[model samples]
Target: MNQNEAVQQNSKPRRVSKKKGKALNNPPVKRLLLPTVVYLIIATQIPFIVTIYYSFQEWNLMRPDKGVTFTWFTNFIKALSAPSFYEVAMNTLILTTSVLMICFVCGLLLALLMNRNFVGKGIVRTMFISPFFVMPTVSGIIWKTMVYNPSFGFSAYFANVFGVAPYDWFTQNPLLAVIFIISWMWIPFFMLILLAGLQSLPMELIEAAQLDGANRLQQFFNVTIPHLVRYIEVVVLLGLMFILQVFGEIYVTTSGGPGFASTNLSFLVYRTGFQSWDVGGASAIGVITVILTIVMMLLMFKVLRRMFKEEQA
Candidate 1:
């Protein structure tokens, strides 16, 4: 019996190893993935390579005579030194952070509310998620015209009803307006992710907490939040990536506005390349934006990891 058991254990490892080897050496899988890999390289990497090349050159479309000379870091220096660049960078940071916080909080609340059994829940969820389906440009236009138009829109109607002044959202508070619109649009996305997380949470854990004399808030903080950490990380990271590149709304609403107040890095890149015709500068900014994105994502991962470890401990 002992020898039979030993033989079975030895054969099991061999079988597992063989499976792993086959998976690793699978020609069919490699063949299937080859086209996708090549397409990704052609579609993404080639443009990035071209952008890097342009960043080292002094290319201004307006100055055709000067014609793309390799200036090597001049564009980087100018991009870093420009006063408007700092404002745009700050705006980008503020917008990304504000939207994330708002979305996270609102989404969590909504998720919690929706997680409970209720009538019309499906319709409510569908309505909540509907905004996410709207195009960014359409969202911007809707808010700009129907909601925020101080003269004849919803704001005006509300202000008149309350006998108060209609505030010019885009004009007086362009960055805040952009933040609000973005948060409104993204909250549903965050809610969807968090709802999935909430639903997947083990009911036994909640029951255990309750039996241990834990109150609702205590259970929520000690149990629910910890369980949702991964979902939160996913929501935050994805939101950060998309929010950092938000341009359509900004373009439609403020157009980077009364002097770069609403200009993010993405909008700045467009403004530099298309409007200002500074191709080199735009390329440099684009590279910098990519670096910033990677660093921020790394830092977020580190912070979340530490939090998760502490929770486990």
Candidate 2:
């Protein structure tokens, strides 16, 4: 019996030998990781860093005669001097905040509805989520051609039925038009994330709240909303990031204008860099965008930390 016990002990799995353990972190794996890391640095990190560096210069990206001379914030000064910059910045911020607010609120309601059991739920979920799966470019094109076309759009058809004008959208209130397009495209994403968060919440807590005389609103406010705060932060931040990056919608729907009316910072960057090939000014704008994003992220993180700390307490 002792020998059998000893044999059983010996039969238990052993840790890998030092050589094998080291081999597990093999050179081949390191080699593969190196290329990916390098690619990321080259494709994203390095270019971003270079853009920041060039934001202080006056190079036109084409004028070899001007070359790589630093002008010590003069590029940024020029960017700030552009009359359209401030308006575009404000428009971008307004669009981003408005889109996030509407999408998140509507998403929460839709997600709550989706969480409940119902017939044809799967198909319904797919339908609701389909917008998020569609490419941004495609979404913009469809909205531009099918939904906002004053002459033949769905809106025009409805307006004609009601004896009202089709009401040209992009030509008039272009900012509102862009916001609607961006919000429509992003609402599905918000719904998916919020729904997952809602479904993953602890059921016992909810039931306990109910047992303690909490009404639906009370339970949601006291328990559910507090619990979902983290997920809510993530959704808001993600929405802001994506919305700030909105260019295709602008490109397709309004081309950043009947004038500069619909131009956001991203579109501004595109116009400066590509359309006019003012690389220095574009880099400056890019740097400003990066700074704004970082500021927003830091602010959100500070708020998030406070909430989580309170949650832990």
Candidate 2 lDDT tens digits, 191-262: 999998898899999999999999999999999898888789878877877887898878887889866799
- For 1-313, candidate 1 gives per-residue lDDT tens digits of 3566667757654554555676644436678999999999999999998999999999999999988799989999999999999999899999998899999999999999999999999999999998898999999999999989999889889999999999998889999999988988999999999999999999999999999999999999999999998889889878888998999999999999979999999999999999989999999999998888878878887867775665544
Query: What local lDDT score does residue 294 receive in model 1, on the 0 to 100 scale?
Result: 78
**Between which residue pairs do clashes occur in model 2?**
none
Worst 10 residues of 1 by lDDT: 11-20
Q: After the best TM-score superposition of candidate 2, give how far the Cα of residue 9 lies from its true spot, in angstroms.
A: 25
Report the C-alpha displacement of residue 268, candidate 2, in angstroms: 0.5
**Estimated TM-score for each candidate:** 0.88, 0.85
Q: Give the Cα-based TM-score of candidate 1 against the true structure.
A: 0.88
Scored by lDDT, the top model is 1
Q: What global local distance difference test value does model 2 have?
A: 0.86
What is the C-alpha local distance difference test score of each model?
Answer: 0.91, 0.86
* Model 1 stretches with alpha carbons more than 4 Å out: 1-27, 301-313
